[model samples]
Target chain A: MTDGLWVYLAASPLLWLAGTLVVWIAASSVAKFRPGNPFLNPIMLTIAAIAGILCATGIDYGTYFEGAQFIHFLLGPATVALGIPLYEKLSLVKSNLVPMLSALVVGCLAAVGSTVFLSELFGFAPAIVASLAPKSTTAAVAMAISSGLKGDPALTAAVVVFTGICGAVVVTPMMNAMRIKDFSARRTCVPWDWHRACLLRGSRRRIVFRNSYGTECNSNISCCTSVSVSQLDSEHLHVDAERRQAHKRDQGAGCRLSQWKSEPGKHRARTRLDAINGQQPRRRPYRRGPVD
Target chain B: MLNGLAILFTFQLAGEIVAYLLGGWVPGPVVGMAMIAVALTLTRSTSFLNPAHEGTVSTSKTILANLGILFVPAGVGIIQHLDLIRDRGFALLAVVVLSTVATLTLTVWTFILVKRLSGGYGND
Candidate 1:
């Protein structure tokens, strides 16, 4: 019975899935406990925990990967799924296309160029430089780019993961200290999802700093959402003003409608009320305080 | 959920075909993403293209939420290159950290300067 159980556990994908999920959940739980503490990042913690487990169990990476590949397959679909958010905020993206695109291009070049230059300065191999070239892009793209440049895909993957974790860990505090509050610039430079993932609240203007190893899709989505929200807010204000003016113009037409118009002032008041009542309740549990 | 997945996969497949026909210079998934975005713009009237739809949004969120997990297997493969890491670890670490911070600062400052030059805001 014991021998049979060991074989089943080793052969089945369940062990890997269960292990990954448990480590992730536990890491996230610890992250929640510490709140803004970057050292407790779920990704870093999960990686460390799993690496420890594999090392302890003496399981070769090949066997471990056979089961892990099941989870890895979802990455492709996830990359495609990024289209949802991108589509939703397409208009905002279109409006700021020039600035956003220029910034992205410059940022991408800086990230890749600096890595290659520094690697060469340190006398590293060309393969290592190639692997590092796409370190700031998403894992899938980075791997593909690495392969194209004749770099080791596995090395690129490791470097990409490390860059992401470092970005998540170090960037937030640095941003806070630097007092970088320009939302447009911030949106263009940093991945907003990192802020969302960090669970920080208030100011809504947190710095994201995605220049190191942020994925293109994520940075695009962040830029779109930031521009959209601000644009939508302005549009909403303009519409409200127009409605108020229309109400004043139509006051002579009908008494009943005028009675409705009497409450035009209340429209802004009600929306503010609705915004506070509707939006805050949903987000309050997730956000512990104004800063953290 | 199923529909969202199918749509994404279909675009990705089309991208793969295009990339292959074009000598595979560009990555298939990136091309697929661009195609999907273009399709979404061209077919904005279609209800299925609505990103806010519950199924589409939820499916996207669920998949992206755990993106880090998908990279684990590849990261673990680093064990095979322990020698490379050991030989060049310090340089690699310094470059990644310093260059990342430098890139972030440069990008952010450049964006602000560009935005200012375009007269988007009055006061810096």
Candidate 2:
């Protein structure tokens, strides 16, 4: 054979992913022994390990993405799952929806505008400037913008990662220094830009996820067409009103929605779970706490 | 832990279907998230108050526990692009900082203004 099967089976991306998994196991193992090691983070360790493997094997980037993309697919489901916590925090979102939305819009505009402006000022290339425009958003969305803006997707990914890491490292301290005790800065960004769960988790763990932008409040990452959960009781019908409205609306769906005290327009979800699978509706409760 | 993770997964898959039917203009993940929020909103408890199942990690917890893992790929991207950053590092740094600050400012402003105009999420 031409070793095609071996090459295909030995795809570089597989090595990268396998490397990633191995690094995680190793770091976690180290953590078990020495929980306080600073340089032992799986993040740093994994990257180094993979880079070393790719170097030793002479695997190019294109080959690595093939298998690595398998893990990338999880991004869709992971992002979607972030809403559960956001919904649980719907009240908090509602209590501060205006501030949140204001922050998101202004933040988006400012982030994009300033980068474009300053990059041009600094005499960066148009492609570089364009790529930088959407760096404030998450990676997937930013990648889309990069392609559209003719900027380097890889470069944009770099900016986004740096942005996230810096935000995580700095925001809390900055807030503390500024005495901005409002603590939660609700940013009504687009849906699908679901990065709020981390901040929520940080808040719950009292670890403070820094520089958080609650863009998911606006729509599906910022794509929320329905009202937030906290606003349900007040903006939603009172029990009697909801009960009556349910009767007036669908009579059936409304009744079901009302059973759980939900607002109609927002939660119009159709869970196409396999009815024939004999699987019961999930009843497990989360211990890590919902929505952080 | 695993059980909770499974619930979270179920929530996501189911939420995807629900969001699509609603004509979501955004990506599927956001819809799934909103769907999860809706489900939790309807339920009597949360991941915090009620433990999903012992020895079975909930989806909610799994995401959090694996949070750092999720970000590792991005970090790796950082390593790959170190050369680019070093070359035009100043401009890139400005972009990252300014964009982040700007987004944060706009988001907060809009949220507060909307709250004022909409009578605080238009509730009561």
Candidate 3:
């Protein structure tokens, strides 16, 4: 090669980055394309396409790796940047922490275990198994795991990238399918029937009470009736959340009407009583204190 | 960019020290992240999340955005492996395709199973 050609060849990294950026810019202009989604992500597609180019040209891996290393540098911080989303969703993480940690552990184990086992059973060689072991985590984490295990980092890196791409793409469809199953299992039904049952029972129960003036009259009848209604209905339509809310509102109005009748002198006092003995606190059994 | 530099330096320092202390079992960044999360919670403040100091984050992204050139070196490795094509080409292809499939399957399955157990009941 001529000296000018040699000088040009040495500047390949700048060309690669510029080319990749151009690809991203083009992909973004496409309406159907989405970043982060494996199917449409420009970065991933570009990476794959570039790899294809190198493979076709029979270029040395060392030279390709040099140009690619700049992109690789960003991987570390991008892995860290995941914390930004994690932080935004921190409340969800904290509130459902047990589930989150449990998910992480279970997900990691199932991922590594199943992949390793199945690959072995299917007769993949040891290098491939070592490479496959860290596919669930981000590329940086996967790279570390592979290196620690003495696996080929390149193969591990490739697997990690592909896994991330698939996750970005397939997660949505998978979730939609699960929701379909959840909805199909518990068909929504109104709670009117349960309230009617409670009302019928209440009608038979004789709800007469002493008025504020000490005269004999029905009092807080609606409240008592609604409570009975909600209880009776809880069994039949447990997942009919909307119906339950509506029933509770109807019950509350009934309670107020009856309460006024029973104690025209002290509606506030009756509310105070309700407040004193209302909802119970929720208990979380697995917290196990700070020591654990 | 400066703010980002601070964040990066902070995490890098924290990660290196913690990882060193821990015998490098896990990564330094992981430790730094945990520490930052803990710190933010204890402070119970969103000031740390302010966009005012986030020029660094934007610039850092820009740097990454302009980073397509780095992969060419690794991509060049295909040159020496051309003979492997005449020999172990099929084996290499099998390894790549199978590994990709296996990785995808494991991630999806685990995420599903975890969500089920956690009662989150969905994917992304």
- Go through the candidates in order and give each one's DockQ: 0.44, 0.27, 0.11
lDDT of 3 by residue, A44-156 (tens): 45556666766665555666566567666664554343333334335544444443343344444555666677667667668767766765544455565677777766665
Residues B10-107, model 1: lDDT tens digits: 77888779878988766677666666666766764547755444566567667765666677667777877778768878888998898778667767
In model 2, what lDDT does residue B33 have?
59
Error of 1 at A27 (Å): 2.2
Q: What is the lDDT for A195 in model 3?
A: 17
* Model 2 ranges with Cα > 4 A deviation: A1-9, A12-14, A25-45, A144-153, A186-292, B1-25, B39-57, B73-83, B102-124
TM-score of each: 0.75, 0.59, 0.56
Predicted candidate 2 versus true structure: per-residue lDDT over A1-292, tens digit per residue: 7588768766656666776667767765554454323234444555567666665777665566665666655555555445544554566666665556555545555666777788888888787777777666666555544665677776675565566645544444443443332324331432222332223222112122221212233211233233233221222112223433543464344235445544332233111011111122222243221121
Worst 10 residues of 3 chain B by lDDT: B66-75
Q: Which stretches of candidate 3 lie over 4 Å from their true place?
A: A1-3, A11-13, A27-38, A168-292, B43-52, B56-124
Residue A113 alpha-carbon offset, candidate 2, angstroms = 2.1
Candidate 1's error at B119, in angstroms?
1.8
Candidate 3: DockQ?
Answer: 0.11
Per-residue lDDT, model 2, residue B100, is: 57
- Sorted into a CAPRI-style docking class, model 3 comes out as incorrect
TM-score of candidate 3's chain B against its reference? 0.60
The candidates, ranked best first by DockQ, are: 1, 2, 3
RMSD of 2: 14.6
Q: Fraction of the real A/B interface contacts present in each candidate?
A: 0.55, 0.56, 0.14
